[model samples]
Target: MAVVQADGRLWMTFGPYWTGIRMVELDPGTGKAVEDAPVHHLATRPDEPYAVEGPEIVEHGRHSYRFASYDACCAGVNSTYKIKAGRSASVTGPYVDGDGTPMPEGGGDLLLAGHGEYVGTGGRSVFKDRGSDWLAYHYYDAEDEGTPKIGLNRLK
Candidate 1:
C-alpha cells in the first residue's frame, strides 16, 4: 500500500497481492488515518486472473484521482504482463470508465502492456509534477531482451 499527499487529504491505493485494486481515504486532521472509511474497488478484469499488483494514486487537480495498476494475468510469465488505469472523483469511488462502466466489471483504460517496446512492465508507482504525470516500473529490457530493469517515464 502507498499513500499520496494531496491538497488537503491523504489518498491511498492498495490491492491484494494476488487480486484487485482498491482506494481508501485517510483523515489528514487525524494524523493520516482512515476514518471509518471503506476501500473502493478500482479495477478488475474477468478474463484475467492471478493478481493485480503495484497500485499507485495521483490527484489530477482537486477532484480527480487516477489509479494505476499492474495486471499479472498469468503469474511467472512475462508474456502475460499488462498495465491498466482507472480514475475517480472522490477518494472512495464507484470508479467508472469513459463510457461509464465500473471497474470490477471491466472498466478503465488500458495504459500499457508487454507487447510494447518495454516488455513485462509491472510493479508501478505514479507521481504528479508541475503539470505532468510519470510512471515508474520495472521492465524487461528489449535490448537485453530477457533481463529486467527499473525505469521511470513520463505518462502522457
Candidate 2:
C-alpha cells in the first residue's frame, strides 16, 4: 500500500490470485476509488505459478522501498514462502533488490525467511508509526505442529 502525494490517494493491490498485483488509487474523501483513474500495472513474477503478492511502497529518505512476498504459502508444514524487498528512486519502479536485480525479473533482496520453529515467513507489510518504521508478517511454526504465527519488527 502507498499514499501518493498530500492528496491522500491510497494505492493498494487488487488481484485475481497468483497472477499479478494491480495498484488502484482510492479517493480519500470517501475511501472509494476515483473511477476515472488509471489502474497501474505494478509488478509480476514472470515464472508460472507466480507467487508474488503483498506490495507495500514506503518513501524513506531519498528512496521508495517496495516490499513483496514470494513463493508458496498457507500449507502449514509445506509452505515455502518468504519476504523480499527492493527499492527504487521513484514510486513507479523498475525495482531492484540489493544486487540490482529487477523485481519483475524475479529479483528481491531477502528481508525475512524461516528460522528455527518458524517456517515460510512472508506476507509482510511495512509502515511508519509515530515517526518510526515497522514491519509485520506471518509464519508457520514448526515447533508447535505448524501453527501460524505473527511476527513484528521495528525498523531503524
Candidate 3:
C-alpha cells in the first residue's frame, strides 16, 4: 500500500513474501526507494506472519493508523481473511493496538471480519471522500456463489 505524507514524500509498504512486510520511503521524482532509509517491519507475528498482508497507513489528527489483512485469502468462500488495525504517533513506527499491545508482536484490534454473507473481508484501503473517511475493500459473497465484490464503509 502507498500513501503521500504531509511532507509530500511518497511511502509504501508491502510483503515481498507472504509472511514478511516492509515499509520504505520513496524518491517521488525517481520513483525509487531511498537507499539509506531505515527498514520498517510491519509483520512480526510470532505465531503466524503468513496471517498478515495488504497493509495500509492513514494519518488522522496527530496519529497514523495501520490497517492490515490477517489470515488466509484467495479461497473464495473458504477464505479466512479479516482486517485488523493499530496506531502510532509517527509515520515509521512501532504501532500499537487499543490495548497497548505492540503490533510487531502480533497485536492489533479487529477492525473488520467476515460475518453473515460476507466472507474474507480484506485488502482494505482508507481514504477521504466528501470530508468523511471511508474504507474500501473486497470480500467474497456467500449468497452469490462466493463471488468477490467490492465493499465500502464510511468510518466514524
* Candidate whose lDDT is highest: 3
Q: How far out, in Å, is residue 131 in model 3?
A: 1.0
lDDT of each: 0.67, 0.77, 0.83
Q: Give the clashing residue pairs of candidate 1, or none.
A: none
- Give a tens-digit lDDT track for model 1, residues 83-107: 6766777656666667878767777
lDDT of 2 by residue, 27-115 (tens): 76777777897776666778877888777788788887778777888999788888888888866676788888887677888888888
User: Residue 78 of candidate 1: its Cα lDDT?
Assistant: 57
Across residues 4-85, which tens digit of lDDT does each residue of candidate 3 receive?
Answer: 5645677888774356567888877887888898778866566854568777889999988888888888899999899999
Q: Lowest-scoring 10 consecutive residues by lDDT in candidate 2?
A: 1-10
Pick by TM-score: 2 or 3, better one: 3
* TM-score for each model: 0.75, 0.80, 0.91
Q: What would you estimate as the lDDT of candidate 3? A: 0.83
- TM-score of decoy 3: 0.91
